[model samples]
Target: MEGVAAHQKRKVMVVADPTRESAAALEYALSHAILETDTIILLHVENPNAWKNPIGSLFKWPSLPSSSKVASSPSSEGLGNGAASLGYAGGGGGGEMEFLEALKRACEIAQPKSSVQTERVAIMDGKDKAPIILSHCATLGIDLLIVGQKRTLSNAILGHKRSGSLRGLDTAEYLIENSKCTCVGVQRKGQNAGYILNTKTQKNFWLLA
Candidate 1:
């Protein structure tokens, strides 16, 4: 049983999305399960393209400047810095307050366990999702990926909306089919947690908040 538990402590990487439930699922998985893994990396990707305003397309100026130009200027540097501030829930952390609180709680709970260490990474601009995630996972020698599966009739029928949820659709499916490591996807059912075993691993491990 000791060895079994030790083997189960494989490194888990949870990719962070802007969604609330995804963040909550990561918080729960880190606190409840993967404390024994080699490491838990919280990866958050911020897509600059997502923020591009359509209004900027209306004018075709002769000398168009990049966002970096505005961001680097002395006058706009403060505004840039201010806009990127991390917020906290208790009016201390900034924009990332909720995330920081979740991480704090997870860390506190994980302190008693000596199996895994946690690290958080905020990716500012990554265009390719699956390759970047897989590259990072490989670089870290990750054994598992724990992600939240949004439960719905549509998702159930059509599968994850992210094209390739964790790995690319094909790679993710292959992992579910062949990878030695497990991929656990959790779905929220009211206050309870329901999970899907995308791999040969165990299914439906309930969390006792």
Candidate 2:
């Protein structure tokens, strides 16, 4: 047993989102997975909007800080900065604070009894979520990636184009097909069919979403 990897803790990254499916997948991993021999990292990537001005490149601030007014407001309406507005408001604190709170809540519910440690950190500025995740895996020596599968209509209809925003696939497709590490696409609670984890025996990573 000593030479058989010793059941080392598996680094699992759960891509957190505002959807019920994501939550379900997270809970499943916690309850069924090796709690003492696995590390779960929950990450919430704020998507970039097409309308925000690229001011982060010219300024010292990493992405724009959210407005106090926007953060204080109770409404969840879209921001004016377009793409930048999509992720974390214009500022780092506004949108990020909320993301952290959500991540903590998710962990509390998913791994109530498990003593596993988790880190809820924001994606680096100007870096896409996919690449950031991959980089994090390499830096942290992660062994696996767990992502929630999003459901979308398979039929696009008469000449209607399929939207990329239908599910969480866009954020994960690249990693699924090209990651150096193993990636698991969790469609529902305990469901594991849309993709394969054995990197040596699979081709074409497909996530329903």
In terms of lDDT, the best-performing candidate is: 2
TM-score of 1: 0.53
Clashing pairs in 2: 49-83, 52-83, 64-90, 64-91, 65-90, 65-91, 66-91
Tens digit of per-residue lDDT, candidate 2, span 36-154: 44566776665545454655323221111132223333342554331233343323554443433444433443344334445544655666677777777788887767765444332
| Candidate 2 overall lDDT versus native | 0.47
Instruction: Evaluate all candidate structures by whole-model CA lDDT and list the values in order.
Output: 0.46, 0.47
Give the TM-scores of the predictions, in the order they appear: 0.53, 0.50
Error of 2 at 50 (Å): 8.7
Candidate 1: tens digits of C-alpha lDDT, residues 1-209: 13456545556666555344454455456445554444566665445556645452232111111222333444443333221222223223333444434443343333334343445443456445545555666777877776655555534554544432445454334334344456566555454333343333443444444
Clash number for every model? Answer: 9, 7
| Runs in model 2 lying further than 4 Å from the true structure | 1-7, 47-126, 152-169, 189-209
Residue 185 in model 2: lDDT: 51
Clashes counted in candidate 1 amount to 9
